[model samples]
Target: MNGAGSAKRPATGEAAASGRAVAATRTGPGGRPGSGKSSEAAEGHGSGPGKSRRFQAVTRDTARPEGGGRAAPGDAPAPARQWPLLAVLGATGLGLLLVAFDAFRVGTLLIGLAMIGGAALRWALPSVGMLAVRSRFTDMFTYGGLGVSIVLLALMAQPKAWLKIPFLDDILHFTVR
Candidate 1:
């Protein structure tokens, strides 16, 4: 066949195998799998003139600027202190232990107080490390609201009475049945 016809035919024999090897070595940026010119440029070769242009563009885009790609030494934020959150967590854990031992009234009070203290700490401190699971306003509202609710519930629990919600007993009776 003529040269044009031969070129149109599929690559076979040694040529096909070598082509596959070349394709396999053409890895992209970060050595990830993709089409780019860096692999050819790295081996001091190019598929065509376009390959060199692609390599130049890739290098230009990835080049770091004047400060070496990091903030200056004094520009970093200080590390957060965690003791106040840990103390609140410890108190809540102790309160749970008290509840397990049947000291329900005192345990509930302790838990509620701990929650209130956590809310106070969240309000007073700028950051609470891992304990700042939510925004400051959200943390304060949730902690304070739950603490007040728990304290009220503890005060009005079985065998005590300072206040009661109407129809709650009826709802409980209906649900239990």
Candidate 2:
């Protein structure tokens, strides 16, 4: 041999055996002869020349405000509370009972107690969040509907000499709905 043909390259000698060694470590024994490689092969997800390989390098942006950490303050949302509704319901329940039963001082006192009890119940019980977490929309509707009804009753009752209901009808109706 002379000129360009003077030299010959040596073979790597490993080929299939070398590839087998690599696959043996990465994959299990089923990757051999009769395993389920057929299905994987069909989908081009098996260890084959035609199969596509994927590599994903997980990265974090440390420059972020919280250094890309878990559960930064802004990640979680604030708990829900219908503040306006709560206040309105509590005040109206107490006011209505007080005025309606005022003729009998004992009755008025008892009604005041009941109103306080109702307020306690409303406060002690979970907000809509707990019901939503439990996927109990029915309970939410039930409690909400009862509160709406109470507000309605208070609105419809005769206006008390001490406290006049806020709106004549329009505003109250709109709000109740």
Candidate 3:
């Protein structure tokens, strides 16, 4: 008979229906599938709330950026620990307040300076607490770009332009007219 019907047969279940191989021998209370996760773990997709942490090592929590620790050490005071972030925040706040008080150009300039300062701090210091909002390269790029943009806009404010770029006028004229 060539042992045609003597071949081993796999048990049929939900795992089989979904094309997932399951360990039919592993059982739990009432002979149910244990934890219903053994199969998932075996599949290397361990994103469930179980012991298997395949690619979710930091699940249920967020991670700080590479250099997003305290500016100072553990023993230092709270303010000192996050001095860089505080300084940037303070400067930005002051700039906003000044703008509210009818000091547009100076306020914008201060805001731009604060952004540049934040970038510099993030670069020069080992840790900058909240100032390190992203990776070192991303943080630096964002801060520097925003600072330069703000400063340029402030310098080129209406009535008088502190910075003169001949090509900019040509582009403006082409676009406006």
lDDT for each candidate structure: 0.62, 0.39, 0.75
**What ranges in model 3 sit over 4 Å off?**
1-62
Candidate 2 local lDDT, 81-163, one digit each (tens): 43423444555556566667663333343444444444444445443222222223443445555555554454345544333
Q: How would you encode candidate 3's per-residue C-alpha lDDT over 60-120 as one tens digit per residue?
A: 5678898998888899989999999899989999999999999999999999999999889
What are the models' TM-scores?
A: 0.49, 0.21, 0.66
Worst 10 residues of 1 by lDDT: 64-73
**lDDT of residue 56 for candidate 2:** 19
CA shift of 13, model 3, Å:
29
Question: How big is the positional error of residue 174 in model 3, measured in Å on the Cα after superposition?
Answer: 1.4
Off by over 4 Å in 2: 1-135, 159-177
Which pairs of residues collide in model 3?
A: none
For 62-168, candidate 1 gives per-residue lDDT tens digits of 43222222221334543224466677889999999999999998899889999999888777766455556566778889999998888888888888655687788
Q: Note each model's CA RMSD in angstroms.
A: 13.3, 18.3, 10.2
Clashing pairs in model 2, backbone N/Cα/C closer than 3 A: none
Give me the candidate number with maximum TM-score.
3
Prediction 3 TM-score vs. true = 0.66
Candidate order (lDDT) = 3, 1, 2
